[model samples]
Each structure stands twice: as structure tokens, then as C-alpha cells.
Target: MQALEKRLKREVLQNGKVEILASSSWCVPVQSIDVTYQPVKRLKMDLLMKMTLLTFQQAEIANADELSELLLVEELFIQDLLRNLTGTGLIEKGEMYYHLTSKGMMQLENGIYEEEQEQETQQLLYSACHEVFLPVDIDQMDEYDELPDLFRYASEEPDGSLTFVEEELIEVLQNSREPEEEGEEQTVITEILSKETQQINDIPCLEFILYDRDKDLLFARVWNTLLSQWDDKLEKQLVEKEVVKWREYYLKA
Candidate 1:
């Protein structure tokens, strides 16, 4: 039993990098280093960047103030980190929000520099999405218990209406669609939703509900319907101009 105890103590000392184990009669040195340390600023920056990237992975846009609150850091510190990250092309500032650029996404998926485990990443994704995308008054819904916070691109209007981006894209698509017969009108949301289900290229479609303080609207589209059509040029244009207008209406003063 004494031998077993001694072996366990040695294992703990080696694994923990502990320097000393004191006995009643003497102090025995276990390892050369007594402590491990990292610069406080560096540690803070590393954590900030990781959390920012994870947040961006879930939300289309994030701002420094929001990030600071989420990371429990000073707003000024987060702003500096964001500026530096933007310069490196890991983050892109869109109007009043910051988005994770393609480069940042690549680095995250490839496990560059600082990478979290798969399960950890998934947990972060779920939490971030819920934080940013779920309706603020979801608990008030009659079927709130049955609702799951699924991933989707949406923005909350100043009037409290949740607008699905894909629904806007669908409206655009519907307007541009040419009638199959002469003088025929384009398909409308009512016609689309009245059907049992809708599909594009054989892929199943999903319905999105835009909930407001007073009303709820239903929209239908397949996953990636809008994303697939958005090219780099269009994305850039939206980020530079249209997204600003969106922010103006969606974000409160």
C-alpha cells in the first residue's frame, strides 16, 4: 500500500508539473518548474478571437459591443481585437456589424491556430444561434413548447416583426419568374403555401415562421435557396449597402 501510494503521488507530480511535495520531515522537489504562466493580454485576446469567430459562424453579423458582453470583456478591448482581425481578413465589417470572412471560416474548419473540439464547436454553434436568431418573445407563443430554434437567416424589425431573408429572396424570385402561359401571373406566396409541400430540384422544403408581438407569418423555402444564389459580388454589394439599411430597421437605436 505504501508503494502504491508513492507511485500515485509521483504520477500526479509528473502530470501536474508540480515542483514540490512536502513531507513532515523534509520537502521533496518533484519537478524543476513550479508554475506555468501566460501573458494576461495574450490570453484575453486569444479567448476573444475564438469566441468572436464562433459567434460569427452562427450569426451573419456581430458587433464588438455584443461580443464584449458575450465574452465578458471591456468594449474597448473587443473593438481593438475586431479592428486587428478585420485587417487580417479574418473578419469583415458590414455596416454596423462584423462578419466572419471566407478566410476565417476556412481557418476555423481547417483547425488553424486555435481549434476547438467538434463537440465543443457544435455546442457553441447551438448557443450562438439561439442567442442571435431566436425570437425575443418566443415563450409567448401557443406552441412555444414545440418550437425548436433551427438555423435560419432572419432579422428582427424595429416593430418587432421577424423577417426571414429567404422569404425576401423568394419574393424576388417570384417577381422575376416568367409566366408559363401568356398573360399568366407569377406564383404568389399564398399559392406556394397552400400546396401540401414545395420543392426545388427534388429537395424538401421547410417553412419559416416570422413572429411578431401581434402576428405570425409563414414562409416556405428550401435550405440554401438564397445562399446558393448569392455570389461574392452580390454578397459584397449587400454587405456594403443593403445590409446597412437592414441594420437601420432591425437594430434599435
Candidate 2:
């Protein structure tokens, strides 16, 4: 500090006035800059920039669904956030997850940053998925006994709804259907819901469930009539393992 003071005094005496630009005042315009002596301070926030940054920061560690939960914001907004944060290296994307970087961790830990409230709400849902099994609220057989009609339906019903995987199946079907059309082959979907039984709304129906064994994620759907075409070894594994549920078949990964 004393050396810096003496240098500044000497410069002032010599130049009469100090003009600092991108580097320290002592930096000569043509000289190489040595940032070793720079002071650390908080970043300045501009109003619009702050809003945009905060929006991205809230979604820093969120996947699509998680981002939706986090920001309760529109899909476009979340997409924008994903683009911004990934572009800036504040967060990283993976096949199935997003993660906050060290700088993000520091900002959160120091309480120097504030994110959207939706982030907290989505976090709760994310925690619930991590804690409880998918197809979580299985109406207890005994509990449903109070309503014999419901119990009877539950008994006849298979397990799982398979709602979440519907979109995935549709994408697959579309791709599979495209090439075959040029070859005079018709798009024939055998079945998506297993021949096994599944249940939805206490009713037995075509079985289907979306299960992610590694993540222990499950979403149940009854016969959407759309997934019947997705039945195959991969789809079968999803049901048999109970990693996904469609009727009687519980899929395991």
C-alpha cells in the first residue's frame, strides 16, 4: 500500500493530473497491463441487465421441466435463460440435468444474488421427485375400501398412467414413420401400452408408465391411445421394470 501511495504521489507530481483508462492510473498507454495489483469488488448491476441476469441465474441449474417449475415462466423465457447461462458458462447442461458453476455457488452462498421465486417452488417439486416414487399418490387399496366402487375399479385397474413419455413416443414414431413412407411401407404401430394391465383414475386400462430407473422418476398415464405404437424391447423394459407403469407390467431399467 505504501509503495502504491509513493508511486501515485510521484506520478501526480510528474503529470499534474492522472488519467486512468482500462487499467490502473500508473499504466502507461503503450505498456503491458499487469492486473496483479487490481482490487476486488462486487460487480455493478444495470437495471435491465440485472433483470436478465437474475432470470438466467434462477434457471442456472434447471432442466426444461425444472426451469418451468423454477421460474413459472414461459417456455420461451426458460429457453432464453438456458441459452444465456450456458452461453456465459454460469451453468452447464447435460443429457438429463443442469448444474450451477462455482461462481453461481459463490453468489448463492454469499447471498449477494437474488433469483426468481419460481426457483424455490420448482425446487420443492424437484425434491419431491427425488424423495418419492413416481406414480406417487397410489390410492391405498384399503383406503379405497371405504368406497367399494372405487376399490373395485382400483382392483381391475393396472398400474401407471405413462403420461410423461407420450411426447417422447410421438417423436420416435414420427421419425420412424418418415423414412418408411418412401419405401411403400406403411407406418404400423403395434402397441405402446403393454398387453399387460395398467390403471388410471381408478380404472383399468391399457398399461403405460414413463419410468427413469437411474433417476427413479415415474409418471403414469392410462391408454392415451397414442403410445400403443411405441411397444418394443426398450419400451417393454420401461414397463417390466416398473421403471414405468402401463397396466400390470411394471418396468424396471
For each candidate in the order shown, give its overall lDDT on alpha carbons.
0.37, 0.34
Candidate 2 per-residue lDDT over residues 110-217, each given as its tens digit: 544323211100000001111211211223211222211221112221233222343433333333333443432233332233222222332211323344445544
Q: Looking at model 2, how many pairs of residues clash? A: 30
Candidate no. 1 TM-score: 0.26
In model 2, the worst 10-residue window by lDDT is: 120-129
By how many angstroms RMSD does model 2 differ from the true structure? 36.8
lDDT of 1 by residue, 106-151 (tens): 7666544331211200000001212222111212212211222322
Which prediction has the highest TM-score against the true structure?
1
Alpha-carbon RMSD, each predicted model:
33.7, 36.8
